[model samples]
Target: MTELLLVATGLRKSYGQTAALDNADFSIRPGEVVAVMGPSGSGKSTLLHCLAGIVRPDGGQVRYRHRELSEMSDAERSALRRDEFGFVFQFGQLVPELTCVENVALPLRLNGVKRKEAERRATEWLDRLEVTEVSAKRPGEVSGGQGQRVAVARALVTGPRVVFADEPTGALDSLNGERVMELLTAAARDTRAAVVLVTHEARVAAYSDREVVVRDGRARDLEHAA
Candidate 1:
C-alpha cells in the first residue's frame, strides 16, 4: 500500500452548539490530489482547516507522516505551517501594497531568505504559472485570472509538501477557473506536493485523483467506498 502523507480519524469540531465536523475521516498520499466536495456550510472548509492544523479538533487525531499534529506545540505547528504547507483561498488574497512577485516571495522572505534570492525564485514561479508579464503589477492591476494564477504561484514558491486550497476558483469565470486548476494541479504534481482541494464544483473536483464528500459534518471517501 502507498504511504499516507496525512490522515484524520474520527475527527470532531464544534462552534458553540454547532458541530462543524463530526466523526469525519480522511487521508491522502504523497503527490496525490484529493478534493473535498460539498455544498456551502457543509463543513468542507472546516475539515481542511483541521487537516492543515489550523484548527484543533475536539476529538480524534490528525497524523502527518507518522507524527501527530495535535501533539505539536503552537510554535511547532506554526513553524510546520510556515515551512511545510501552502494555502490558496477563494479571493486570491494577495497583499494589496505588494507587487505580484513580492507577493509570491513573501513566504520565502518570512522563512529568512534574502530579498534578491527570494524574488528571483518567485519570478520563476510566476513564469511557470504563466503570469510573468504581471510580475511587477500589483494585485489590483491584474485581471481575476491573472491574480489567481499569482496566488497559485505564491502557494507553490516555497515548495511546500502539502497545499490546502479552499475554493481556489470560486471568484473566477469557468474558463479562468479551469486554467487555474490546470496550472495548480500540474505544478503540485511536478513538485510531488499533495493537494487538499475544497470545492463544490464537480468540474473542479474532477481534477483530483480522489474525492471525499463532506455532508453535515461527516465525510465519505468515494474511492475507498467503491
Candidate 2:
C-alpha cells in the first residue's frame, strides 16, 4: 500500500466575506501527483496554501506524517516549510541578482549546506532539468521556460517530501508548459516525492495521478464524482 504523506481534514478558510476553502479534505500519498483544478476564485490556490502551511486555515487540521500543523509553533511550521516542503509558483520567483545555480542552491544553503557542495548538487539538478547551459545566467537573462526550469531545480534540490506547485506553467506557452510539466512530474517520480499541483487547465491536470475539483470553496475528487 502506498503510504500517506499528508492529509488535510475539514479545512475552512475565508478572507472577510469571501470564502476561500470550505470543509475541504484532501490527501496525498508518497510519489503521487495530485492536481487541484477549479475556476478562478474557486479556492484551489487557497487549498494548496493551507495544506502547505503558508496560510493557516480558519479551522481545520493539516497533518504531515500525523503531526498536526495547527499544533506546531510558527517557527516550527516555518522550518518544516523550508526543510520538507518545496514550492513552485506561477512566477519562477528566482532572485534577479542570483545565477541559475545560485537560485537552485538557495534552499540547500538555507538548510546549512556548504556553498560549494550546494552548487555542485544544484549543477546536477540543472543538468537533469536540461538547463545547465543557463546555469551562469540570472533570472532576467534567461527565457521564461529556462527560468521555470531553474525554479524546478531549486524545488527539488532539497529532496523535499512534498512539492506544492501552484500554476507552475501558467506563464509559459503551451509547448513550454508541457515540457515543464513533464520535467516536474518526472523529477518528482524519480525522487519519490508527492506533488500537489494547482492548475485550471485540463492538459496540465492530465499529468496527475488523480484530480480534484474545487467549486464554491469545496473540493471533490473527480474520480469519485457521479
Candidate 3:
C-alpha cells in the first residue's frame, strides 16, 4: 500500500460548549481524492481545516509526511501551507481587482517566482482547466463556474502536494458543479496530488476514491469501517 501522506488521530476541537470534533481520525494517501462527506455543521470543514494546518486541534495530532502540525511553530506552519498545501473555498474567493490569470499566479509570486514565469504557468493552468477565455477577466466579470475554475487553477498552480477544498461546488448549479468536479479530480490525478474534499453532496463525493463520513462530531472512514 502507498504510505499515508497525511494522518490525524484522536482529534478534538470545541467552540465554547460545543464540540466541533470528537476524537476524529482521518488519513489520505498520495494521489488519492478522499471525500469528507456530511451534512452542514457536521465538522467536515473543521477536519479539513485541521488537516491543512489552518486551525489547530484542541487535542490529538495531525501528521503530514512525518511532520506534526501541532508541533510546528506558527511561521513554520504558514510556510508549510504555502509550500505544500493548496486551498479552494465555496465562494471561489478571488481578488476582484486582479485578472483571473493573476489570481492563479498569486501563490507562485508569493513563493518568489518571477512575474512572467508565474503568469506563464498560471495561463497554462487556466488553459488546462478550460477557462482560458476568462484569463484577462476579473473575478467579478466572469460567470460563477468560470470563477470557480479559476480558483481551481490557482490551487493547482503551486503544484502543492495536497489540496484542501471545502464545499468546492456548493455555490454552483448541478451542471457546473459536475464539470468542476470532473476537471478538479482529473487535474489532481494527473499531478498525483492528494485531495481532501469536504462536501455534503453525494454526487460530488462520487468523484472521490474513498469516502469518510462525518456525523455528530465523529468521522468514520467507510473504506476501513467494519
Candidate 4:
C-alpha cells in the first residue's frame, strides 16, 4: 500500500469575508509528485502554506504521517517543518554570505549534525546535482539557475519525506526553468520524496505524476498522465 505523507481535508481559510481556501482536501502519497494548478487568487499559495504549517487554517486538520500538524505545539511543528518537510520558494533564498555548500549544510548543522559530516553529505548531493563546481561560490557569484539548483539541494539534503515548492521556476526563462524543474523531478524520484509543486504553467505540471486543479479555493480530483 502507498503511504500517505500528508493528509488534509475541509481546509478553510478566510480574511474577513474573502475565502482564500474553501473546503480544500489534499492527500499526497509517498514518492509522488503532485502539481497544483490555478490562476491568480485561486489560493494555490495559501494551500501550500497551510500544508507547510506556515499558516494555520481557520478550519481543518493537517496530518503528516498521521500526526495532526494542527495539534502540534509551535516547537514541534517547527521541528517537523525543519526535519520532515523541505521547501523551495520562487526565489532562491540562499544566504548571499554563505557558499553554496555552506547553505546546503546549514540545515543539517542547525539540526545538530557535525560540521564535517554535514559538509560531506552536502558536497555529495551537490555533486549529484552537478553544482559541485560552484560549491565554493557564494550565491552572488552563481547564475540564477545555479542558485535555484542549490536551493533544491538544500531542500533535499536532509532527506525530507516531502518538499513544498511554490512557483519554483517563476523567476527563470523557459530554458532555465525547464532545467530547474528537470532537476526537481529527477531529484524527487531519486530520493523517493513526495514533491508538491505549485505552478500556473501546464507544461510544468506535466512533469508531475498528477495534476490537481485548484480554483475558487478548492481542488479537483487529480489527473494523471494519459
- Model 3, 66-94: lDDT tens digits are 99998999999999999999989999489
RMSD of each: 1.2, 1.6, 1.1, 2.2
Return the TM-score for each candidate structure. 0.97, 0.97, 0.98, 0.95
Task: Give the winner by TM-score.
Answer: 3
For candidate 2, list the clashing residue pairs, or say none.
Answer: none
lDDT of each: 0.94, 0.93, 0.93, 0.90
Instruction: Name the better of 2 and 4 by lDDT.
Output: 2
Candidate 2 local lDDT, residue 74: 96
The list of candidate 4 runs beyond 4 A from truth reads 222-226
lDDT of 4 by residue, 1-226 (tens): 6867788888999988999999888888888999989999999999999999999999988888988888899999899889989999888499999999999999999999999999999999898777899999999999888888899999999999999999999888888889889888898998899999999998889889987788999976443211
Off by over 4 Å in 1: 222-226
Ranking by lDDT: 1, 3, 2, 4
lDDT of 2 at 184: 98
Model 1 is weakest, by summed lDDT over 10 consecutive residues, at: 217-226
Q: For residues 112-159, what per-residue lDDT tens digits would candidate 2 score against the true structure? A: 999999999999999999999999999999999999999999999999
